[model samples]
Target: MTLSSENCSEFQYQVLQRSQTLDANCLLFLIILGKMLLNILTLKMRRKNIYQNFMECFCISLAFIDLLLLVNISVIFYSRDFVLLGMRFTKYHICLLTQIISCTYGFLHYPVFFITCIDYYLNFSKTIKLPCKWQKSFYFSTVILIWIFVLAYVLGDPAIYQSLKTQGTSPSQCSVYVSVQGYWFSFSMVIILFMAFVASWPDIYTLVQAIRITSYKNETILYFPFPSHSIYNINSKKALLPRFVICFLGTWSPFVLLQVIILLFKVQIPAYIELNIPWLFFVNSFLIATVYWCNCQKLTLQSIVLPRDPFVNWKCCFIPFTINNFEQIEKPISIIVC
Candidate 1:
């Protein structure tokens, strides 16, 4: 069939859109699967520790939320052109689901963050060690508190109500769009809280003292504590502080600041702003996995299976299998008839 210019443009747009949606779904699926497998493998390898178990469970929950968000986005995109098809599905239902999930995951940030900080504090403080059962109870209570706070705040905020009113773009398409004003307030609060938490480090005595003497700040990197030093390693206070800052600021710095600026300046943020939110999520996920892998010896052992204690250097054991595979492939090639 011959295609007119209008038809060709429309067809190409649909194909491009579908291709992008499929890519996102595949990437999200792989990430979720990788996380789940890693968690299972880790659990099998090591006796469960309280912090580790909480992290694994929390990650699983986050993964589920991510999966839900992706599925909703996919459905919306798939039905974009056909209002009747979209109407049959109802965007409002999906949008509500997304909002709930979004709020759930957003609130989870505080507790997870607080727990990480507390974990570091407890390790450094040399306080009385609790039994695993007690620790589990404490962790659950913290999570409950987090959710309660989220619900309470959401209920009080008039923004959600306003956003609900504007739910669907067309009869076919629904979205819970946060008012620009509400978005700014919520975004600012998170940034302020994050900064406060980071600033609560009293033991940053050295860094603070160093800051006083460092003039011009151009040589600041040289003056700051480097990770390689023994002083930095054993002290959970020192080690975790940097990790927390890197994670808290690095992953979120872009989107948070962007929102704040957009709100303060009363400028319309470019379409790219919405796109960055998901990109930030991906960055945060990768950063957390990397941090856990690099710092937590207990976590690394669980990512793979082995006969003996895998902590005894897993890389050394894989060489023999790799060599055998290479030899087998070499022999097959040598014996092949041209």
Candidate 2:
């Protein structure tokens, strides 16, 4: 009996060690991925066109915020047992901090996609035009106001603040907990879900428009000998819009739905889902980063290849004009008459 007990203890120790190692590896991967995304977005922002575009600026800003969130998570995960600033941070503190940051920035993700849809609508539609002078200022102001509103909302809510301060910390797990009975919590989830759906409607409309436009262009090009290179470039950029919309919906919609179900119905989410929902943000970030990289590649290729001038083939040949005096022509007629 003693020998069997010793073997079982050895097996348990080995399993525990492996689990710790796996957790460390996953954390390291997330950090590296976040760094890569930050670098790519920084490079994209450096480009003149990207800097000038409102949507691209928003995208880069979102990426930056996401990276900060990821870093905070990494710090919280790795330092769960460590004391900071002469104070011990329990699991509740870590979860509270994470929740606050995520809530503040997380609301922006869906809006970014909605803004992208608007950008596409403006680009493809002929009825509306935004002036160049006001575009940058307008978008910049809007982004700033959004951040301010989110901060105010979180800071001004007494119930949310109190709950964060008083939530119980589990000894075995550091995770975010939402009180199902909290009115603010339930209300926030409803708001988020509503916004998500509202944002998706425009995306769906824009996608259908994109598909119809692409097919029409393809058909037109098939019959025309001189296809406009500019049209091709515009279409390529439009392609990215749908891809991004799809990716954003895929990565975030399910998670949002799960939250809605939990908050509204007071259903207990499985341990596996509760543990994995946070990772969806990381996945969303990765997809956006991939899109940025693909865009950079397209830009590089465009820079290398000069676009052909549309009027080059239509140049007319110059013909010399000869003018003859009336008297000079009459002399030849008179000589023939004589």
Candidate 3:
């Protein structure tokens, strides 16, 4: 027996709604997984360094911000006719708050990577010598200022407009709309992508230079003359700048490029891409978290092997080691240089 037209329409609607709900739940699951991984890595780093190093502090702060953003997105996903923690928020309010928080946290990621790169270059290159206390204070102040500026910018005009639109509307009638084709919006996307590219360049350059310098010789050796009385081996702290830079760029560049194309050309994004963008963000979060976790592992191993063999001590600090044949070595003599 054929179904009535009204019944067919109702069935289609139910199927669509169910599909959307399933998609949202899957995205939320991915976000939760990413947050859990990041939290574990951040906690480990905090315990290891206690915010003593600028990189450790930056990683912890970034992880926290990312978790907050992910939670906000998850709230927005399931806020439809739902009560959260005994308080009922209109879907409009939830969506607006989510947008504001996401934008603030997303844009803030740029500066974190930028400043981390700068710090890496300065510390490793031994350029622009400054007191340790002064450097720490400067970095801490900069992080605070960046968050303040991002929050202010995100909550200013754009958020206010969305908030005003939702006013006087019933909770069930509330919805979110972003004008991707607007001139100002496109311009803003361009500006953001440009800034990210510029910010990433210095780190990329530093990585390339380091690799090139190490590649020319068969075995690149690093000698750190620590104080005789010092128990901890500070010599093996090789900067993982290259890995961090690669991870960030690899994960984010695709999303940024997609935004640029869509905004600048007034092109509609494909349904597949629209569905996968959130997952991309999750992948990015996971990769960055793994980078921090790996670095923490390296630090832990280095701490364990504090007083290494003096013969291999100079070579252990070297990154990107190469194996040498006897022909390259010229002789079987052990050359010890103090």
Could you say which candidate leads in lDDT? 3
Q: Lowest-lDDT window of 10 residues in candidate 2?
A: 313-322
Candidate 2 lDDT, 1-338, residue by residue in tens: 35688899999987886576447436544654655465565444342422244454554555565566566556766675667799776434545565565445444444544554455334333245667668777777777776688667866789856654554343234344432323243355457436544655664454434321111212211011112332323224443343434434444566556666666786753221132213323333333333342443343322311111111110000000011231232221111110
Q: How high is the CA lDDT of each candidate model?
A: 0.43, 0.43, 0.45
Candidate order by TM-score, decreasing, is: 3, 2, 1
Tell me which of candidates 2 and 3 scores higher on TM-score: 3
Q: Candidate 3, clashing residue pairs?
A: none
Name the runs in model 2 displaced over 4 angstroms.
Answer: 1-53, 73-93, 109-134, 167-338
lDDT of 2 at 101: 54
Query: For model 1, what is the error of residue 151's alpha carbon versus the real structure, in angstroms, after optimal superposition?
Result: 3.5
Q: In model 1, where do residues sit more than 4 Å from their true spots? A: 1-54, 67-89, 107-111, 168-338
Q: For this target, which candidate reaches the highest TM-score against the unseen true structure?
A: 3
Q: Could you tell me which 10 consecutive residues in candidate 1 have the lowest summed lDDT? A: 213-222
TM-score against truth, every candidate: 0.37, 0.38, 0.40
Tell me the spans in candidate 3 whose CA falls farther than 4 Å from its real position: 1-4, 38-53, 70-98, 117-141, 159-338
Error of 1 at 209 (Å): 30
